[model samples]
Target chain A: MEEKEIISIWFIIGCLLFLFGVIIFAANVLDYYVPWSGTVTVLHEYRAGIWWGAFLIVIGLVYSIAFNPWKKTKEAA
Target chain B: MLGLIVPQLAMLFTGSNIISLGWVDSAIVILYFIFVLGIGFYLMKFTKTGEDFFMAGRSMTMWIAGLSFVAANLGSLELMGWAAASYQYGILATHWYWIGAVPAMLFLGLIMMPFYYISKTHSVPGYLKLRFGDGASMVSAVSFGFMTVLMSGINMYSMAIVMKVVLGWDIHFSIWVSSITVMLYVVLGGLLSAILNEVLQFMLIWLGALLIPILGMIEAGGWEKMVDRIHQNFPQGDYTHLWSTLGSFQDNPMGIHWTGIVFGLGFCISFAYWTTDFLVVQRVLTAKDLRAAKMAPIIGASFKMFVPLIVILPGLLGLAVIPGLVGETEAIATGGHSYNEVLPLMMARYLGPGLLGLGITALIAGFMSGMAGNVSAFATVWTYDIYRPIHRMFAKTDGTDAHFVKIGRWTTIIGVFVSIGTAYLVQQFASIMDYVQALFSFFVAPLFGTVILGMLWKRATKAGGYYGLLAGTVSSIGMWLWVKMDPTALKIIALSPYAKDMAENMYRALWSWSICVAVTVIVSLMTKAKPDSELDGLVRSCTVLPSEGHLPFYQRPVFFASIVFAVFLALNIIFW
Candidate 1:
């Protein structure tokens, strides 16, 4: 695979992982404030949800557009 | 909190609603599995060689290798074992985090990396083959190969037990799902996929576990209020102090003297694990350069210093918040769930459904990473050290490099299936599991003793290495059996009312290591030593010393190790 292609694939995977974290975090927010009495446990108030979600999103963004990782691979090549 | 009064049990993960995950929670977990599997499949395009299969072709950056190194060490034991231990023993458990790990890790990074890196061996046993000879190599390899598979199986059983008790997931379901998932990634991308996934899991563990200490402090009003509550509750119990209670075995709840903690654990067990264990060292060996290899453990050590905060605090919080949690009647009635369930309980109470699902997935991720670490390491050791020799001596013609990779994958299949069987058998003969683990601990101290002498002393011989390891392992087992046979001996040793099981373990490691060193020195003097020219890069005087002297102050390992050591001292003094 080309170096460029590998970077792009990492970016897409990172984005998807970030999306998963975001969805989990959003579900928590809905549960916390929506006053829904559904038998589901929603961590709307949990700090870990937001922290992990934000961290994944940043990691995604870094992989998606960061020139540094690409440069490192180039150097190795 | 609508979850407040819906009680079957009011603690975290105390729900009876098995298989009732919300749509988002279900989707999140499904995506995690798919994404991980996808990485494995995708990376298979690149994994065509033995180098790729075993060591990721030694191209990993520090962040990738370092995170994987630490995450692989964080197993179900990290989640449940230490958490429960902290709940039972209090803050003194932090010793395992700091003095037990940091110094040993730094020693590996600073002193040991050049030899391991410069020799260019695929596994620790391969290094043994290079340094000692085929005899020592085969001994270490066979033992490591068998032990890893058993450890993987135990990892599976541990995960199953947690899921069964907490989420009511059946043991078979846990076993199959975990085994298949672990096998998929490992067989697909080999070491790289396993490691990348470990990095992800490491992040998840912190996200999942950090909440207990953070929120527990809030609930107890603050650290001071929490300490006050603990004092009021267990006034006679020395649970808050770290070293202050360690003046004597009778004085400490741990039934260990300060000397035992420092030497037996911090020196013997720590050195044996960090320096000799292939599971952890393999990650560093995959780094792109020598500097990255050295830096990997430093990064791991920095992160390790904070682990006790996540693992130990929840147990301490349990004392102040959870009613009758420490009582044995409650402990047994709940299926040993009181203390063991502390981390999950804290998660359930604090996290809602989405976060709860993620937390549980994080735990499963931790277990799978451990299983993957064991399986992958076992595959390498089996193929290179065990299978190759047997094939060469028997009917095997010379195989190509690809043939070895194929053998490795076959070993992975065999190893995983074997682990599944072992996991089931472990369920029946739980007592055997203790002996298997004891056997592993038996190897560590003696192995370290041999490795250290070989690296530093030019006169160490191959015969000495094998014989020393044999003697050390035998003595360790003999002492362990003696202690198990006579529990009264601990009382006589310490004259303490506390159970001296852990103390006995530490002292045994010290004794075993001492015996190994003594036997090796005596044996080496009697045997023919290898020529120094033959020991190039495997011994201190023969290898090029790392150029840390020319590097900037912050980049040097000594500078970082010193900082970590200083923090370690301050933490001990503060908690003293």
Candidate 2:
């Protein structure tokens, strides 16, 4: 019931998303240089992988960092 | 016509070399649906009151609210609409993303958010009731509730039509399936489920759609090569230049005068929609504090500028990669696609099946996200603004929290059915999304004019508010009919021969906004203004943003606003 616990759950989900993104990024980078016949790469070379990977990591961090409700309080707010 | 198009579309999907969704694609879509349903069902326990159902318990973080804010606008129409716009109007469509949005979003955070947050209002109509009194709230409530449902229906119809055309899915099946799925989450989990799913959809759309422009560049050799190909084939240098085409309506593909694009769209329509439309502002309202509320749009704006990369660039790339689809007529009759189909056609050519499924799912999710936002907002406004007032008046007592929550749920069901009816109505239009946007323009331009006056100038009276909204809506509708009845009226009324159809929506907003402002000011001057004491924290003079001065430099809205504004200017300059 605690908010942080819920945030932690979301943070973990974000981590999983980041993990999937990294795998896709690694595959795209590797497959660009060396072909993998059996591997199915979704959304191949048509993205900014560096930005995309960084975005996923950043979102993971945000879910971890931004979900804290008690870290700072504003009485007027 | 159904018999003809259905078989033809099936063959077109097969023989046109368009990539079809395979088993992996189907699984991706099905899994996403199930995942969202689970999120909805699990969140149901959290919704026990109207506030919880409607405002996500007002506990949303900035990014959650921010992503939902942007994602709400990223509806099926936005993904496909801008693509279609770009396919027809060229890079000029980027103005809608940047000039038409960024500054206005910044304005909402920087100027208007303090009043909204400080007032502690639940919805935009709730704010109106606080500022202008009960009558203004009722007018706003009625119009906003109607607009929300109509917009939702537009999204539903658009999703259905796309599925029917591209995947050969039944229109009724698309409508029923998506509607039931959206209803499950939104009706059960309320705003929390909707916002959370929207965040999920936002990620999917970016991850899936970023492929089109990226792979598209690779297909055309590079970004430079794509530009060269566009110029080589179309030979209109203005196609790539944003400001260049604004010299004259006759000179541009959009046939819209610069005044219309810059002032009418960039100022009037964009400001109204960003600042006032409940569908978008509702997301920002769900944030926990003024800091989160103020930061939401700024955060949304940061991600928003990159949107053209996915939507507009795909349309530009389509010019190079997909040949022989020029006008809508040509696209539909011969190419077996429409200008709106540009996004999908490019995706089909570029993405393999698994990724293709994800891409398609993203588009479908966008529609569902949009529909959920509208239906939920409609439910909230209906329960709080419209039905609550009427029920209170008739019953002579306020209902219990549980009773209101029950009414909210039932209202959501009715709202969805109304949207279904409106969705069917969309089938009758040539450009359904355009009609929807135009209808939105009619409502918002006037609403913004009234809201801005009420917030900034305390002299705006209760009588002034209601009449101004009424006059503005009526004038815009009359102007629209005038132009519709006589095409030459554009030159007569708008004072430019260039305004017609889509371009007319922009200027029509300007005219109605002018009407709202003029009527409200004149009526307020004549009638007695509301006492400033009664207007306490609702007006600009009395209101103060909570986290305005105390926040660290990096966390400040002004800081983010400055960055977004700088980038917006840089983009305009670079594109110029």
TM-score top scorer: 1
Worst lDDT 10-window in candidate 2 chain B: B1-10
The C-alpha local distance difference test score for the whole of candidate 1 amounts to 0.77
Q: Write the per-residue lDDT of candidate 1 for residues B1-576, one digit (tens) a residue.
A: 011111112232343533345677667777778877887887788788898899988887776777788888877657767777787788988898888999998899888877898899888998889888898888889889999898788778777776776677777998998899989899988887788778777766776667667778888888788888988888888789998878876776777889888998999999899899999999889988998888888888888888888788888887787635653346445744456567777776666556666767777878978888998999999998888878888856766889899999989989999999988887777655667777788888888998888888888898898899889989888877776788666554334436466777787888899999999899999999988789989999776675667889987767877898898889888888
Task: Write down the TM-score for model 2.
Answer: 0.89
Model 1 residue B560 lDDT score: 79
Interface RMSD of each: 4.3, 6.0
Instruction: Give per-model TM-scores.
Output: 0.91, 0.89
True contacts kept of 1: 0.26
True-vs-predicted CA distance for residue B424, candidate 2, Å: 3.1
For every candidate in turn, the CA RMSD to the true structure comes to 4.6, 4.7
Off by over 4 Å in 2: A1-77, B1-17, B332-338, B428-437, B544-547
Candidate 2: deviation at residue B438, Å? 3.8
Chain A TM-score, prediction 2: 0.49
